[model samples]
Target: MTTTKRFFRNKRDGKWLGVCAGLADYTGIDVVWWRLGAVLTTIFALGPILPVAYIATGVIADRKPAELYRDNFNPEEERFAMQTRRAPLRSLKDVHGRFRALDRRLSEVERGVTTQNSGLAREIDSL
Candidate 1:
């Protein structure tokens, strides 16, 4: 099954309400960094607002499904998903560039093959 790139509370890796862990999973950052940031923000800056938001997020967000990362758990796929989420247009452009490169390479190969063997080229063209 395909997993949607949606944020879910990672209770399995959480310390308290899974908020920090969830944030880490969603943003592709380390959980420790998220925890540290939350603590520092709570202690120094936002204070009540941060805590309230955390709690609200914990309450509102669904618990991460166990199977979400189980099937086809590729690190590259995860990174791509994170990148797509963070900057969709950039991801799309990157994909387009890759496809264009691949098309150029394939065209070069076809040109080479056709130039070397006219009969093979005719057969390929017929197909």
Candidate 2:
């Protein structure tokens, strides 16, 4: 997974654009839980301050692109991660095994790309 530098309006506790969701994306926390915490924080002890902050955040902070919430998350920070770069594994148990697997896959892809380029070069030479 490529690590895209995401920009989301997280000026406050959030629901849509997954402000909370975007936060979860950046922090590796569960979105549902963060949302709950924000809700609880607002409801229990704070004045209108929390709610007002949420509104302000909505207006100010960047919002995640609606479609990007899916598996392929692309956001703007001018730091778009390469697709081939693997995102940190959610867990090491399954992750350790995949490194070798990924290396093999990348190697194969590299071979194919290199072959195509070389063939193009050869054709140019012939011309």
Candidate 3:
């Protein structure tokens, strides 16, 4: 099954309204980095502007779905999800490349199994 990637507030892991946490999730960055950036920007740079934007984002963004990562907790899956969210076309190309490699490997295995190649059988038996 395929899921459309969208930004969602991660209230479960968030300290505030999950804006920073959502940003972390979306960008594959640590939540601490997002929180620190927000705090630093609020204090040293944008002042009230940053806070206002954060509040607006919290209010506007949808809460993360409970079933979004429900079944498994795989770090690789999370990384892939983040990459897909960040650059979908690049992710598509990566998946296509993986499938192509797998197809090539499978065809080689089929050839080895279907043909009566003594050398290939001896090589398999040695392993």
- TM-score attained by model 2: 0.46
In model 2, where is the ten-residue run with the lowest total lDDT? Answer: 77-86
Top candidate when judged by TM-score against the true structure: 3
TM-score of 1: 0.70
Model 2 bad stretches (over 4 Å): 9-17, 66-127
Answer with 2 or 3, whichever has the higher TM-score.
3
* Global lDDT of model 3: 0.85
TM value for model 3: 0.76
Q: Would you list the C-alpha lDDT of every candidate in the order shown?
A: 0.83, 0.59, 0.85
TM-score of each: 0.70, 0.46, 0.76
Model 2: colliding residue pairs: 1-86, 1-87, 9-61, 9-62, 18-21
Error of 3 at 27 (Å): 4.7
| Tens-digit per-residue lDDT, 1-127, candidate 1 | 3335678998988998998888877776778999999889999999799999999999999999888755656778777776776677898999999999999999999988767787887999999
As a whole number from 0 to 100, the lDDT of residue 10 in candidate 1 is: 87
1 or 2, greater by TM-score: 1
Model 3 misses residue 66 by how many Å? 2.1
Instruction: Report the candidate with higher lDDT, 2 versus 3.
Output: 3
Model 2 Cα lDDT, one tens digit per residue, 9-127: 53333546346766665665656877887789888978678778766766676766545444544443212222212244434434566787999999999998777587788899999
Model 3 C-alpha lDDT per residue in residues 1-127, reported as the tens digit of each score = 2244578898988998999988887776778999999999999999999999999999999998888644666768777876887788999999999999999999999987898988878999999
